[model samples]
Target: MYMLRKFRKVFSLIILTTMMSLGITAPGYAAMLGTDDILAGDNLQQQRDYVKELLNRDEVQNQLADMGVDPLEAEQRVDAMTEQEIQTLSSQLEELPAGASALGLLAFVLVVLLITDLLNLTNVYNI
Candidate 1:
């Protein structure tokens, strides 16, 4: 019984030493989120969803196809956009006139995609 206790103590000591030496510990960080920060995250997601929904529309998809831009590839490009880019696009979308034609919206999207392609941020378009 004494030998068993000694072995357990020694084994535990070895394990603790090994763990400490190897630095096998997970680091954590915590911060209190402000209302604006939390709301901004939600708003960003909503903006992304709104853009995706617009892209998924049959008219938009058809326009993209006609322009030789794959709708799926365009969606992927939007996903890769930075927060600033999304915010800019979303703001522009909000600024559109209430009577704006679908063609105007489609043209705006195509222009954005073309700029991204030129910047080499996306490979959706051959040009």
Candidate 2:
């Protein structure tokens, strides 16, 4: 037991000495952010979240798909975009009408389908 205790003490002392000689510093605790930093972090997070939410809309996803762009790819691209680009997109989304007047768009689609059916381009609905 004495020999085991002595060996343990020696091992601990060696580790301490090696660490001191290597100048190994303990990791620091995080510092608190200033008001400006806090506000900036909040704003950036809000912008990123806003852009993500806009991309999640069914209309936006469908539009991207129609343009031959994968909606998932578009979302990933948004993450790689610059802060200015994100801000611009977010602003544009805010200014645009939600879902771009879903009823109007649906009506237009129905009319186009009807016309195509008449032209025999499509025989949907047997119209």
Candidate 3:
């Protein structure tokens, strides 16, 4: 225990001496990240990957197929888009409200209608 305590004191002393010798001092004020700095720190590839992930969603793939676009071809097109396009798409996707799409609403309505018809709570479909 004595030896451990001595070692700790020596270590602390060494650290203090080193700090004094190097003139190390804490900053007077905390560093602040500006919006431009934060945005600039993000790389193009990250934006591309985000856009790719969004495109790979099942709903997105189904929609692409419905629009007569092959999912693989859409992926290739995403890769072909410029960095700016990827950024734009990623930003737009980020801004969208979840489950607020027209397709999503249509599916929700269809499910509700089917459920009501099955329970005989509604005669809307006469099923």
Candidate 4:
């Protein structure tokens, strides 16, 4: 009985020592995430969805076609973009004007032509 008790004590001591050594060698880490850190992942997904939706639009698709860009390839490229690039693109999209009138575009073109004519870059106008 005494021998059994001694063997049990030695076994317990070995287990305790092994556990302590493992605890020292392999420590676990935990940290509290901030709201931004948690939401950033969701925001990236939302941005990707927004870009894909834009790519799916008929007008956008037609524009891409006219520009010789394949809509599917553009979408794949968007998918391949890094988080920072996606965020920057999303922010730029937000900053774009919601709509522009044909008259506004015509005026902008006329202004550009006038500027070029004044600089003698082109004799588009006999001014």
Each model's TM-score, in the order given? 0.76, 0.54, 0.46, 0.53
Query: 2 or 3, which is superior by TM-score?
Result: 2
Q: Across residues 34-79, which tens digit of lDDT does each residue of candidate 4 receive?
A: 9999898999999988767766777667766665556676677668
Q: What are the per-model C-alpha RMSD values against the true structure?
A: 4.2, 12.5, 17.1, 13.4
Q: Whole-model lDDT, candidate 1?
A: 0.84
Candidate with maximal TM-score: 1
lDDT of 4: 0.67
Per-residue C-alpha lDDT of model 2 across residues 7-118, encoded as one tens digit per residue: 9999999999998889966888998889999897788779878777766778756865675556676566557656775676566556656657433333333454456568
Pick the lDDT winner: 1
Estimate, for each residue in 15-87, the C-alpha lDDT of model 1 and write its tens digit.
9999898987678999999999999999999999888887788887898889888888888878988899899
**What is the alpha-carbon lDDT for the whole of candidate 2?**
0.65
For model 4 the local lDDT of residue 6 reads 100
Model 2 sits at a Cα RMSD from the real structure of: 12.5
How do all the candidates rank in terms of TM-score, highest first? 1, 2, 4, 3
Question: What pairs collide in candidate 4?
Answer: none
Candidate 1 vs. true structure, TM-score? 0.76
Give the alpha carbon lDDT tens digit for every residue of 1-127 in model 3.
9999999999999999998989966769878999887776476678777766766778867876675556675566557656666676666666667775435423433454456558775444567
Which structure is stronger by TM-score: 1 or 2?
1
